[model samples]
Target: MNSLLILALILFGFTSFYFGKSRIKKVTEKGDLRPKALPHFYGYYQALWCALPAFLIIAIWTVFEPIILKNLIENKIQISSLNEISQDELNLIYSQIISFSQGNFSGQVTKGIEAGAITYKNLLSISQGAKVSLFFCTIIAASLFAFRQINKNVHAREGVEKTLTIILFLSSVAAILTTIGIIFSLLFETIQFFTKINPLDFFFGLGWSPQKAFISDPTNLTPQEAKDLKEAFGAVPLFAGTAFIAFIAMCVAVPIGLYSGIYLAEYATSKQRKWGKPIIEILAGVPTVVYGFFAALTVGPFFRVIGDSIGLEVSSESALAAGLVMGVMIIPFVSSLSDDVINAVPQSLREGSYAMGATKSETIKKVIFPAALPGIVGSILLAVSRAIGETMIVVMAAGLAANLTINPLEATTTITTQIVMILVGDQEFTSAKTQSAFALGLTLFVLTLILNFIALRIVKKYREKYD
Candidate 1:
């Protein structure tokens, strides 16, 4: 019924647009004075008025409907009950009522439940009918008001532009507010986590075993227990693993991606570029989970076999495998952006370099590369961020053991992987072990922010130098 109402409203909006346009056209034809705005502007003006208020009413009704239904059910149940019902019990009874109403309940039905279900059904039907009437009344009233306002003197274009500006501003505000909300949520949880564990221990301590912090009584820990708990949440290993994996990924990505970008931008023929660039960029569209499976099932085992042949011990789930796969995944980001940036370098620079008796290689080395440095650096940093934040490949290819080692052949875990491990399954959110995930998240967020700040500074420096 709601879907039907929405479809009807959309049709009505379209009809109102055409009607308003034709009405305005008729008004202009009858009068000597011309309209201040275009006919389509009046159409837009009418469409907005005819639909916006009706849509607002529907939105408000949809939001309040569940609350209204729940309140009515609660009141009905309360009146029928003999004893005082607790909130949990009432919630449970409401669940049962919902199940019974939906024909999913298998247990014996109580009189109160049967009565509640019948009342619910009747009220829902009545509410649906009322909503339909209200929606039509709103549309009719709004449409009439809009039609009456269509005149030669109406500044419909100005009104539509102002309305659109306001909507765009509100959308920007919503996006900003959402980001602020996420940051605050992370900060609040991280603060809660820090209250339970020492900040120094969490940030700088070598060990990382959050499961060991699950004590019998978290609130009242003895000195020994407190020491154990302090040592349990150490994040140094996670940080090391993240940096090591990201470093390895950069090692694999930078040379290949940069060279590929340079080749495509500076050397490739049109035919080679058209085919080659898209083929390379296809890597970016490949899903991360697909990369994860490739790393886990193919790359990891291949590395293990190579290691065995060489008389070296390589873990089947090794950081090297994850990093190599991650590097391939982010290659397109670096290569595509670098190619664009390189191509954007001025033709004047290359011509001047040639005029100075510089060879093509010299022109490229000293002129184009320097000019495109900022964007190239930006692309590389963006790829580094992707590598750091990646979870799936690390989870599948690299084992979830926070071993604080620099060995790429050994199994290691990143901050993201540990956070996933900490939060997965039914978790006690209030526990120090679970809240540790937030702390890791906050730390990772800060590190990424710092990396971005550095990248910005570098870009600014080089951009100023070039510009």
Candidate 2:
């Protein structure tokens, strides 16, 4: 019903646009007066009037209809059941009623449930009908008002522009608010988690076993059970693993990516660059899961074979395998951005360096590079962030055991991988085990934020010196 109403509203808007345009044309032909705005602006003004109010009404109704229905259903249940159920049980019953009304329920039905489902279905039908009727009335009234206002002196352009500006502003606000909402949600959950586990143990403890914290009821743990339960939230291992892997990825990505960028920007023939750059950047389009599969199935085994030949024991799932695949994935990010920044360096600088008898390599090192240092730094920072946030490659190639080691040949895990592990099943949000994911997430967020701040400071310092 809602979809059909939206379709009707769209058709009405298009019709209004034509009529508004024709009205302006006819008025100008009959009188010597010129329109205050273009015929198209008048058309847009009328179309917006026809569509926007109806769209708003539909949005409001969709948001409130379920809430109103839920209350009505709960009231009916309370009167019928004598309010014998707890809130949780009531919610479960409501869910069953909703499922049955939608013809998706598989559970055994009782008389109460069947009656509730019938009531819900009837209410939904009435609500949908009213919603459609109200939407059509709104569109019709707004269209008539806009048509009457369409005259030689109407400020159609101003109205249209103002409406568009408000829309864009609201869009920007929505994005910012969404980010704030995510941050605050993580913060709130992290606080809940910390209340159950000590913040110091979570941050500084060396152990990473969250399974020990699992309890059916946290409030009723016996002293021995609490003592036997070694809730090791020591996140140092996860942090160490994340840093070690990112460091390895940067080591692999930076030199090769920078050299490739330089060759493309300065030395590669036009034909070579035209083909080579796109092929190099194609790495970025390859899904990270594919990289994970390649790392797990192929690279990890090949490394094990070579390590065995050299009498060095390498784990089947090692940080080296994940880091190598991740580095390859990040190469395009570095190379593409660095190439653009290097090419952006002024030609005059290269010309002057050449005139001063500097070779191409020396000119690039001393002149062009310094001029483009800020942009190069920015590109590297972006690549580092990409490496740090990666999860799939690490989870597939790097083992989940949080082995706090610097050796790339050993198995290790990262914060992201562990978060995935912690949240993989049915989670009770109040349990310390499930809440630890939020804590890990909050810590990762802080680390990323700090990295960005430090990068910005470095970029600003260098930019000031260079510019």
Candidate 3:
């Protein structure tokens, strides 16, 4: 029914556009006066008037229809059952009614649910019918009003442009507001987490055994229970592991990705580029879960075998294996962005370098690299962010033991891996264990934001020098 209403609206809008253009053309043909705008602008103005209000109404109805329907069904159930149902039981009854309406009810049906289902079905039918009727009425009224205004002196172009400008401005504002909303949500939860766990202990303590603080009810704990909880939320180890793994990944990715990008941009034949670039980019398209599997099943075992051959103790799940696979996964990000940035360097710079009797290598090293340094740095920073946020590969290849060792052969955990572990199963939101995930997430967000800010400053400084 909704799809049919949308189709009708679209057809009406198109028809209005055609009739509006024809009306203006006929008016100009019969009279000596000309229109204030072109025929197409008038057509667009009529089409917008026909479509925008109906679209807004449909969107608003879609958002609120389920809430209104659920309330109506709940009221019917309460009155029919004489208010004997508890809130949880009512919720279950609502679920059963919905299931029955969808023909997927697996539970035994009761009289109250049957009556609720009937009420729900009737309400849904009426709501859909009213929606279709109101939408059509809105379309007809708006089209007629717009059609009457499509006379010789109507400034259709100005109206259409102003409408489009307002739309663009609203879109930008929506994006900014969404970002602000996410930050505030994380901030609120982090504050709640810190209230339960001391900020100094969380930040500076050496242990991270969240299981000690895992209680079913956080609010009812006695003072001794809280004191004996042995909660150690020290994040230094996770930060160290994250930085170490990212460093290993950058070590593997930067040289290879930069060299491949330079080769593709400067030296590769057209056929080589056509075949090679896609093959490199295919790494990025592979699912992270698949990479996790590859890390666990293949890379980890292979590293263990090599380590045993040399009589070195090597865990099957180690930071080295995860970092290696993550580096392979991140290669395409670096290579593709670097390739585009290198290609963006002006040809004149290369020509000038060549005219100075410089070799190809010298021209690239001195001229092209310098000119593209800002973009190259930007791409590397993006790759660093990607590595920092990766969770699955680290979980599969690097064990979730928050070891503070610097050795890559030892099992270590990252902030992302710990976040996943802390919130994996059923969790009480008020528990210190669960809220710690929010704190870790907020820290990661701030770290990335700071890294980006520093990267921008560095890029700006170099960009000014080069320009």
The ten-residue window of minimal lDDT in model 1 covers: 458-467
Writing each residue's lDDT as its tens digit, candidate 1 over 117-188 gives: 888899999998899899999999988888888964588999889989998998999999998998998899
Model 1 RMSD in Å is: 2.7
- Model 2 regions more than 4 Å off: 1-26, 216-224, 227-231, 464-467
lDDT of 2 by residue, 267-372 (tens): 9999999999999999999999999999999999999999999999999999999999899999998899999999999898899899999999999998988888
lDDT comparing candidate 2 with the true structure? 0.90
The per-model lDDT (C-alpha) reads 0.90, 0.90, 0.88
Query: How does candidate 2 fare on TM-score?
Result: 0.91
How do the predictions measure up, each by TM-score? 0.90, 0.91, 0.87
lDDT of 3 at 437: 92
Best by TM-score: 2
Tell me, what's the RMSD of every candidate?
A: 2.7, 2.6, 3.2
Candidate 1 — which pairs collide?
Answer: none
Best of the candidates, lDDT: 1
lDDT of 1 at 244: 95
